[model samples]
Target: MNYNQPTDVLLIDDDVVNNFIAETLIKRASKHTNITVCLNGRDAIEKLLSIKQESGKLPEFIFLDLAMPVMDGWKFLDEYHRLNIGDGSNSEIIILSSSVFRRDIDRALKHSVVKEYISKPLNIELIRKVLKIDHHTN
Candidate 1:
């Protein structure tokens, strides 16, 4: 990876263990990036908004959990798109939930800011796949 290329990522989950595991996997998948985790959607939104306000350096990607307390992924997506993060470059949100229900998937697909959906227990391969997909799409 190019040292100059930014690989910052944001993870939002209520479970601490899940957050740690996801962050660790991301780090293992790519050594040249910075990863930040938020315990819930509300916190993640605040942090992201602050980043935009302070440094204008929002994370390139956001791994979001749907069934979180305080604020859920759907609410986050609503607020996120309302911000109008144009060009979709501020951050790309990927739903990282254990939910496999078709209704949940359908709802995720309806959101413009939601780039993709990922399952729990993130792995290096999945991270790589995300990178590749984003690279290709972008």
Candidate 2:
């Protein structure tokens, strides 16, 4: 796949394997894309704050996990909103979770910051769809 535009993507997951898989999938989707990994929501918030302070910018995409140590995705969203970090419009927070519960998905989607919700094991097709790239054309 090819992405004409460069994208900064953040993967916030407690699982190392999940992070690796997401990173690989993102790379496969577009070589020009940059991927950042955060093991927990706390670290991800810290990283985002630092980036905003240093560069006055946020990642274009954020792959968030609902269940994580230190701070969960819901808590992170609360903190992120409280801190007034990022413009919210620029960054797309996609909830990447293993939760099969409809309630969980509905809650996540109901959040203003959350753009979409996807199940675990982020794949090439899912990445492409998220990026709004036509697989056939790419």
Candidate 3:
């Protein structure tokens, strides 16, 4: 698989601090990425639907948090599955959560839509690894 950074990335996390940190890390990892932040899963879903309807293209990557108010990541997954947006190539979802429980990790990995899972406090290294971006800078 190509490890090039994507043009568009969506971040679904309720915590403002987490979102800020993750966005910053992503920017540091790849300056070309355009990051969008959603405070809850519901809004994220809505935004995605709109984007699909309008542009017929989903975001290249989605960094999702497991716990949120209006709609949790699990619920979002259920609803997203119903949408059947992409052909499993255009968009990839990564679960970014603080939950270390084996069950949560297992459940997330089992989902067809979820590509990977990462613990909270996203960093530059994790971002590069997840996005498959090269570490060496010219």
Candidate 4:
């Protein structure tokens, strides 16, 4: 993926501090992208649906958290795929969670919508890899 192109990113996490930290890391990783934050899965789903309906395009990328109130990442993925949210090759998903279970990784990979699985303590290295940004500047 070209990190220089403007990409729309949706970040869904229940924890405020994690959200803030992740967003900051992402921003540092790639300056050419836009990040939108949602506190929970339900809200993320609603916002994503609305954005798609209004803009005729789903977000280029999504970073999801596995656990939360109202709805969880698994539920969101179910709903998203059920809705056929991807607009061909333009959309992708990345799962962000504290879960280190093999089952979790397996489940994430099983879904066609998901493109990558990442663990917590979000930092510059993960961001660089995910965004495919060069590290020479750092």
The C-alpha TM-scores of every prediction are 0.87, 0.93, 0.92, 0.91
Query: Model 1, residue 47: what's the lDDT?
Result: 92
Stretches of candidate 1 above 4 Å error? 1-4, 85-90, 133-138
lDDT tens string, model 1, 67-88? 9899998888888778764343
lDDT of 2 by residue, 1-138 (tens): 236767889989999988888888888877788899998999999999999989887988899999999999999988988998866448899999999899999999888889999998789999999977676765
Looking at model 2, residue 73 earns an lDDT score of: 94
The segments of candidate 2 whose C-alpha lies over 4 angstroms from its true place after superposition are none
* lDDT scores in order: 0.80, 0.88, 0.87, 0.85
Backbone clashes in model 4, listed as residue pairs: none
What does each candidate score in C-alpha RMSD? 3.6, 1.8, 2.0, 1.7
lDDT of 3 by residue, 1-138 (tens): 243544789999999999989988888878888899999989998999898889887888899999999999999898898877665546889999999999999999998878999997788889988887887850
Candidate 3 has its poorest 10 consecutive residues by lDDT at 1-10
Judged by lDDT, which candidate is best? Answer: 2
In candidate 3, which residue pairs get closer than 3 Å at backbone N, Cα or C atoms, i.e. clash?
none
Residue 128 in model 3: shift from native, Å?
A: 0.2
Report the error of model 4 at residue 48, Å: 1.2
| Least accurate 10 contiguous residues by lDDT in model 1 | 129-138
Candidate 4, RMSD to the unseen true structure? 1.7
What lDDT does candidate 2 reach at residue 36?
A: 90
